[model samples]
Structure formats: structure tokens, C-alpha cells
Target: MTVYALETSGLTKQFAGFTAVSDVGLRVRRHTIHGLIGPNGAGKSTCFNLLTKFLAPTRGTILYEGADISRAGPAEVARMGLARSFQISAVFPHLTALENVRAALQRRRGESFDFWRSDRILKRYDADARALMAEVGLTGWEETLAGEMPYGRKRALELATTLALAPKMLLLDEPLAGLGQEDVGRIAALIKRAAEGRTVLMVEHNLNVVASLCDVITVLTRGKILAEGDYAAVSANPAVQQAYLGEMAEPAHV
Candidate 1:
């Protein structure tokens, strides 16, 4: 049996009178790309937050490498190698791409963000910062301010920063949310490369992208698991097809 990198049993979240996620169990294997997808209100985001420890679950046990982390805090989970990216860009707009990546590298090295540090202390991180920027295909734009970069590049920079953490499991919430058709492919390729030795669990709306990148997919609908399988199996599911009607175009079907 393959030991999963992450797992959830009876995962659930309740907000007042409504249940956002109910009795959800997920088994994300090691070093594979897995996707969570559904319609607008399918509790994808809620489940994501639960796994990332952004929100405490009302009831559930989250296991990471066989350890229960349901009670772990966000920072704890991050330090434990579970990192997440938000839907909105998470870069510092004023910082140059190199500077932004250098800062993240510095943080990972246990350096405080104290601005009083000398140039020598900061320069120590430059080489690695440059390599990370290049890893995300931001090599030539190193000196540009993050805000000045185009939207796609900005998203890449955000991903570069996330990579600085060197997480074992990465959670991306709508990684391709806002981009042109062109940028979508670029980011998708980047994601595939980033998943080389890490487990990635993503919540994405673009079914085509999901189809191409995901080794396995779990579909949620109305806060429940509608289907789970490879892209072809899930896409062929009658219930999944019915649930997606009107929510997404028919061409998105696999």
C-alpha cells in the first residue's frame, strides 16, 4: 500500500446553520498532482482551507505523513511542509522580482524582516533568489518591480515565493483563476514542473487544464463528493455531467 502524503477522514466544516463541507475524505498520494473541482458553491474552497489549516474544521482528522494535524495552526502546518497559494496574487507589488524572492529566501533561512540589515546580509540570498526566479521562468524580469510585471508574470513571481518555502505538499486554490488562454498554458506547465517531487492538491475551475495535469481528480458538488477518479472516468460520470450543466461549457467536458 502506498502511504499517502495527506489524508482526511470525516472532514467537515459548519458555519452557523449551514454546513460548508461535510464528511469529506481525501487520499492524496505522494508526488502526484491531484485536483479538487466543482461548481461555484461546491465547498472546494472550504475543503482547501480545512486542509491548509486556514480554518479549523468543525469535525475531522487531517493526517499528514501519518500524523494527525487537524488541530495544527496555519503556521504550524506551513512549517510542516504544507503550503498554500491564494486566489489573488500574494506578491509585494513594490519589490523587484529578485528582491521579492530574496526576501522569501531570507525568511526561510530564519532571518527577520528587519530593514536595518546591511547589504551584505541581504546579498547572501541573491544567488538562490535568482535561481528560484529562473525556476519559475522569470529570469530576464529579475530587476522589474513585481507590480510592473504583466499579470501572468506576477502570478509566476507569487509562485516563486511560494516555492521558497520548499514545501513537501503544495495546495493551490484556483491557480489559473485569472489569466488569458496563453498565460493559462504557461502556468499549467510551471505547475507540472513544480510537482516533480512534491504532492500538489489544487482546486481549479478550468477542467481542461485539470484534465491534462491531474493524475487523479475528486469532484465535489453541493458540499459533497460527487465522483472521484481519473479525468476520463469523472468526466464520463453521469452525475458529474448533470451537475456541471449550465455551470460550465460543454466543450470543457473530457
Candidate 2:
């Protein structure tokens, strides 16, 4: 088998004659956490969309587990054990945290979401759903409505639902965005735990979390790779430094 969990070659995306991602290649090793960081408008999100099949690439190839997935749809890729979380917390607002996770568990079992089904039919997923909730530190919030939960808790719940799919690879888009300092630390730790036995690809603006959690970091600027290495090596590169232009504050040690 392949050493890489995901790979892209000559990946390019253009919007109305403007190239957003140009001639990019990315490789993520198996069972490792890889971080993608760049300044605003660097096409990080666009690249992510292409990888997840939310947007079609203008030209390129994407391989997941050595199989060509460039032509696959989002749901197809997801069912193949590649799951993604959004920049915004995506939870069913009216559903309790446990129910939200149960919904995902149902999907994983290839069952249609029969909201009208009796509680007895749905109870089969409860144990697994609660386990996932506990995995993300939402044990006590199981009965709480997802929308009523605090922002940090909502993010945690989202992670729980994502985990219910039992994915082999996770694509997290800005997992630390809009978080307070305390919540940032908590969520970062959760992400670390989630990476166990799974490959993770994350796009985050939080430099400290990236430095501590990522096994490899790829720096992009103006939609192209500027440098790729460990945090120390990438941080020391003059080109990467110039690209950030002081936005790359010295990350605090975790």
C-alpha cells in the first residue's frame, strides 16, 4: 500500500480567469497530522474544497488511499472514510447533542435518517453515539440542544458527530477559528486526541496549535507553496517569513 493517506498533483482551480490554486501538489502521510497555513486569500479554503470534492478542480488529480478520487462527489468520498468538518460549527440546531451524533451513526450504518421512527428503533445507536460524545468531552451535555450549547461545546459536538462516521481521514477547516484562549487549548487537545490512528489535514490560522500538533506544515502564499517542513524549519525560511509579513508572530510554546 501507499504511505500517503492523500495526495494531489498539479491541482489547479481557476475562477473566471483568475487562478486560485496553481500547480499545487500536496501529500499527507498515513496516521499523521498535517497542517496547511497561509495568509488570507492564499486559496487555503479553495484547495480544501477541491480536496473534499465540494468544488471541482479546473485541472488536476486527487488520490485518497492511492485511488483516484478527483471525479468523486462529496458524499462518495465521505462514505469512503474521508470526512470533513466545516469552518463554521455544523450541528443540527434543534437536536440534542446525543441525537445529533446518533444521526451521524445512522448515516454510517447506511440507514436513512428516519426522524419519524420510534425511539426503540433509534435506541440501537445510543451507546455508540454517547461514546463519541464522551470522546470529545461532551458527556454531560448529551441532553442539551446543540444550538443552546456554548460556542466551544458546539465545536466539540461537531467533532463528535464527525467521529461517529468512523472516518479514517479527517479534513478540518480552521478548527480553531473564533475560539477564546481557554477554548483554543481545549479544542487543540481534542484534535490531538482525534488524530490517533487517523490521518488529519487541518487548515488553521492559530500558529501555536499548528506548531505543537502538526508533524509537517505546508506554508502557502498567493495560492502557491512557499515552504514545507517542520514548524522550526518553515518558520526560519526567509520566503515564508516575508510572506507572512509579521503576521507570523512567534508562537507560544504549548
Candidate achieving the largest lDDT: 2
lDDT of all predictions:
0.90, 0.93
- Residue 202 accuracy (lDDT) in model 2: 99
TM-score of each: 0.96, 0.98
Tens digit per residue, CA lDDT, model 2, 1-254 = 99999999999999999999998999999999999999999999999999999999999999999999999999999999999999999999999999999999999999999988999999989999988988999888989999999999999999999999999999999999998888998999999999999999999998989999999999988889889999989888888878888656464476
In model 1, where do residues sit more than 4 Å from their true spots? Answer: 246-254
- Cα lDDT for residue 110, candidate 2: 97
Model 2 worst lDDT run, 10 consecutive residues: 245-254
User: lDDT, candidate 1, residue 245?
Assistant: 88
The digit string of per-residue lDDT tens for model 1 on 5-122 reads 9999999999997999999999999999999999889999999999999899999899998889999999888888889999998998888999898888877777777556888978
